[model samples]
Target: MNGNRFGRLFQLTTYGESHGDAMGVVVSGCPAGVELSTEDIQRDLDRRKPGQSMITTSRGEPDEVRIQSGLQDGYTTGTPLGMLIENKDARSGKYEPFVTAPRPSHGDFTYSAKFGTRNWGGGGRSSARETVNWVAAGAVAKRVLEASDHDVRIKAHVSQIGDVEAPEVTFEEMLEHSEENEVRCAHPETAEEMREVADQHQTAGDSIGGAIYFECRGVPRGLGAPRFDGVPARLAQAMYSIPAVNDFEYGIGREARTTTGGEYNEDWEFDGNGDPTPVGNDHGGVQGGITTGQPIYGEVTWHPPVSIPKSQRTVDWETREEKEIQVVGRHDPVLPPRAVPVVEAMLYCTVLDFMLLGGRINPDRIDDRPGEYDTDYHPRSPENVDD
Candidate 1:
């Protein structure tokens, strides 16, 4: 109910629940006069909307967006921009059983304890559905960043679906391939395999978890607040807000913990232009809580959807008795592909806030850089590409 706002200078506050009639966001502190419209927000929403692929939930929500205010003639008015998306396909009845029996691996039990009651339908505020607002706000933030001539772009893709994964591709390549498939993976072969696995899991009444890799381009140095708003902390905060995100890390994540400093620390050097250049991409673009101006990259891992058609044991909070619960309602068999754009939106928001803090660019006017950076990231196909 509280703490929905993110960022200091360019702030965004999101509200509404999954089954609520509508979800929306209010963005404030944005500079006046940047090009924007409901279509811009709707474009991203369409990517995150359910039923886009066979691997995702079958919910039929169009996730249509409507901009209530904050712009004139397709540009920001410098006031708080308000936007909302109606939830057209909610079936609150699917959550009737959870009135007493909470779903495991979800916030229901804890929310019940803390709030003493909950909407239960579509997991209420805890639902991944809430992130639609983030995407909406992010669309505006992205425009703000773009207007500043920052020459930055954010993108995400399904890197791994259970055991199937694509080969590591460059940031530019990933952007090229992400939107090509429902799984939002660039590699055709791997996306197919991942889709097959998702289908199998759905058939078995199960769900699968996977990893999402994100890349940030053209982010100038000195964007973080240090010690607190450090790049990692900000990115982590935004990433964790996505429901089902169970783990996060950059530059090897847990793998780094297993190595010695000698093996882990990235050695620095100077490029021919005398600018500091990372000897390797090991650090993933952040050191000492600030950007190195390289591609800021990292990943978010989503746990398998906790709700499954197969019955599972849980306790009836009121009865204090153990019982089997078959989670009903629409649920994703796999969330990686659809999550790609959502991650991009969050990354966009994070970078926009960082850029604002760094003063590298301002809204209303942006520098002219014709595709300063080109992304070459491509997803690997599990069926053909080898590790």
Candidate 2:
């Protein structure tokens, strides 16, 4: 619970449970006077909502966002932004059987072991349902980034489902074709195949895992710090927080194990603007923990939903006896496709917060003809502030 907060400057603290009255987020450090509305955040929540597709959970929660506080006349108030989404269709009775019997590959055991108690209703804080706040918070982060001078754009798509991989696509292609399919894969042929795979798994009462690729363009160089707060470190930390996520890789990632340094090195060259640009993104747009003014790309893998219909063995908390369970709740047959926006949202928070921590970027002044950011907030250094 202590680690529920994320980011250093543009921070978010989420509360509520899977079957709680409402799940919400408190966003802090947002500058005053940025265009914001419930509609802006609701769109992203709709994308994260359940029952959107047959492959996803059939829970009928509308996931409509409500801005509780921190906005005045459609702009941030430089105060904590409060937002919430009510749990309209949680069906806690469906989880009654799980009160004593923990599901396999779920946080039921770990959460109980750590806290001495746990909410058995729909896995409580351990549920993907909690990401409504993340997507909502990410929606705010996107506005912060959009308010800045830089034209940073973030996009993500399902690149792989089960053993099936989508054809490689560019960032623009991802934007164009991701929503064309229910699975949210950019490759039309592969998206069809992924849907078919999900159908097959659904018929068999099994679940499958897959990976998603995320790309962020226009990420200004020098966004992250060296050592502890490196871009990779922050990105990994943000990503691993999502439920069912099992792995995080950037650039060539694990592929580099087979690639020699000589082959991996992408020589730099000057562009039309004389900015140093890498001929290739083999480094995934980062070097030495800093953005290289290139498109930052990475991939995240989510394990299959743990609550499949097939019977699985688990231990009883009270009886200390082994038992079998056929998890009957609604769940996603494939998770990575739905994960695309979540990835984009987390990436936005990480980068936006890093920018805030690094320097002052006034969204209003970013449009100045001179192309200079406003320094209303001097850097939070000892020399800039008085005791």
Which one is best on lDDT? Answer: 2
Scored against the true structure, residue 345 in model 2 reaches a CA lDDT of 91
Q: What is the per-residue lDDT of model 1 for residues 1-387, given as tens digits with 9 covering 90 to 100? A: 688998877889989988999998998877876777778778888888898766778889999988888877676667888888999999999798888888887889898899888888899999989888888888888878767756788888899999998888877778687778777777878888888888899999999999998888888876686788899998999888888888989866778868898987777898898998778767778888888878788889999988889988899978889998888878899887778778888888888877776777664344442334335545564655776
lDDT of 2 by residue, 117-220 (tens): 88878889988888989999999999877877779899999999888998789888999999888899999999888899989998999989999999999888
Candidate 2 Cα misplacement greater than 4 A, ranges: 363-387
Instruction: State every prediction's TM-score relative to the real structure.
Output: 0.91, 0.92
Could you give me the TM-score of model 1 versus the true structure? 0.91
Cα RMSDs, all models: 11.4, 6.1
Residue 197 displacement in candidate 1 (angstroms): 0.8
Clashes of each: 17, 0
